[model samples]
Target: MTDLTPPAKRPANPRFSSGPCAKIPGFSLDHLADAPLGRSHRAAIGKAKLKEAIDLTREILGVPADYRIGIVPASDTGAVEMAMWSLLGARPVEMLAWESFGEGWVTDVVKQLKLDAKVQVAPYGQIVDFTTVDFDRDVVFTWNGTTSGCRLPTGDAIPASRAGLTICDATSAAFAMDLPWDKLDVTTFSWQKVLGGEGAHGMLILSPRAVERLETYTPAWPLPKIFRLTSKGKLIEGIFVGETINTPSMLAVEDYLVALKWAKSVGGLQGLVNRATANAKVVWEFCAANPWIANLAETADIASTTSVCLKFTDPRITDGETFAKAVAKRLEKAGVAFDVGAYRDAPPGLRIWCGSTVETSDVQALMPWIAHAFDAEIASLAAAA
Candidate 1:
């Protein structure tokens, strides 16, 4: 092992948990004073702010004018549930998963809904074959596997003339990747991801075809009031504009507005993607030089730029879980990083957030700390042996 001493340069800010990520560069509660607190979300002022969040999301993300984007309850999960409950039974379903979040959706469809669905799965650090997927059937998949660090490159696998809808969980992908609007019938993401805003509210974007499905077909199962998207055989246009299905957190709404404004100030989506790309490159080069670590995703082309997961390659370590946890503990005790450990269901490894909210300089500063922690762990193991 190299020097076990800690690195002198620490990340200026070490808030790198995947979700509820770092806030915009200079985020402050001062920016949220005019949040219209203690006011009804249905009130004109509160509605205006909510509408502003949706509008800014459309402009910043370049969502098509015809697509309907709404702020819904329960973050990304709620949004996905709304889509699945409202739309799945109308057609034969095909669900694809490579990580925890994606698999969770598949469970909901097959187990809960009991729908006629075909489930395709890939282990952690890998992705299912999109080419083998039949676009003629409705498909649900995660655009970015946050826990696995694998992502769908483009919408090319989806045929343009397909008869089905593509529902994608893009929680970690939004604001950092280009989503093919034309290819997706429904897309869901939370503000707490790449944009680093508040949680419990999701931005659900629906294509024209998805709207038609909602208006034309109804599911055989019962849908709770929260999951209902259409009313009286028509899409609820008010929800698309500013009126939410239920009470919303105005404080969270205002914070998301600040994030969207920051995104615009930083040259919009492209700039966000570039910053994430640069951050991922740091880990890429670091892994190249360090033989002990390798990216969890084997396919370089499909590797994620947002949640960059890495696995230990050093053969000396017999207990992967214990070794990885020890290294993560060292980093946390040193206050150099926190919550960088792999997800509970994922393979034991490190999962780093490299979204736009994360700075390249901070990631750069974090590199040495990680190496130092690794060496210290290895040496401790050797001494114990």
Candidate 2:
């Protein structure tokens, strides 16, 4: 029942997981030869390397001159929690969720912190209505819902003069999409995403308003040492300048520096966006021609460009979960692709990474393999019938 006639070509690289995505096309361990291995992070050389990573990040991301950026512990989650615990209790909160990660943040606000929060949530594959949110109440949400394959269509929902702060989880969105920095008060992302760097640390970007919030308000709950951004009623300016609270992985830092350098070499943020947009077009065109396969996202405008998700619409597939898993397993077994399965919390479908680090050519090459796998699954269903 399998399709023995394989495609003429295969994806050059088959490492498309949602996170820790494909590395730069020419990436090699040889590039990290200069990493300060075994050197004390507090040493002058170690400090200089860390500062270099920070400077390049700011320059490439085009962060505002006044905003503060810091390399924090954990991944994006730590950055988000630090902002939440340090600054949230000062005002009433609005928790909006459309996917697993968003739901986790909602749980933290309403149940754990027990704040006076209004929860607005939507089912997977759909977005919540931004109109229902009260801007006067601090709003927390995921800029890109990675699991459900949806993203914020625009920042128009947030007013510039709004009284409350906007905290966003942009781990999967940052480099691949345009973030309205003026509209966001606190934004968090990790290197494991679009940059194709290691996931040893997270990046936290704070607007002037976010800094003011930290200076003016402190949560009643206890703050862990790692989450502390202020000391004795004043902001710790050193952390914002590469003085990390804990020892960081110099190896990971070197890897991230390599990624940043590559990003600049490719024409900065717009170039990265173009790569992701072009890669996602391949999935869009495939869905258009193949009636059986369709995007899981409900709306085209809000669809994810990085983690492209698709569901099967054919009548022959009796069990969506079983059939989708079979298709992904077949692709993985053939070595044409790997980890293309839908996220555990998402709908039964296929999830492909189309971030900047993933080559459009690789995505184009993988299409035939996908079709072969789908056709093979269809044949299996017919045989079973």
Clashing pairs in 2: none
Tens-digit lDDT string for candidate 1 (1-385): 3676678899988988999899989788999888999999998999999899989999989999999999999999999999999999888899999999999999999999998799999998789999999888999999999999999988898998989999999999999999999999999999899999988999899999999999999898988998888999999999999899999999999999999999998899999999999999999999999999999999888899999999999999999999999988988999988899998998998999999999999999999998999888888888999
Candidate 2 per-residue lDDT, tens place, 1-385, comes to 4555879899989887898788887999999988999999889888888889888988988889899999999989999888888889898999999999999999898888889799899988888888788889899999888888898888998999899999999999998999999999999999899998898699999999999989888789999999999998888988888889888999999999999999988889999999999999999999999999998888899899998989999998889999999999998998978899999988999999999999999999999888888998888778788
> Over all chains combined, what TM-score does candidate 1 have?
0.99
Q: Model 1, which residues run further than 4 Å from truth?
A: none
How many steric clashes does model 2 contain?
0
Instruction: Assess each prediction's global lDDT (C-alpha) against the native.
Output: 0.93, 0.90
Q: Candidate 2: where is the Cα deviation over 4 Å?
A: 1-4
TM-scores of all predicted structures: 0.99, 0.98
Give lDDT for model 2.
0.90
Error of 2 at 111 (Å): 1.8
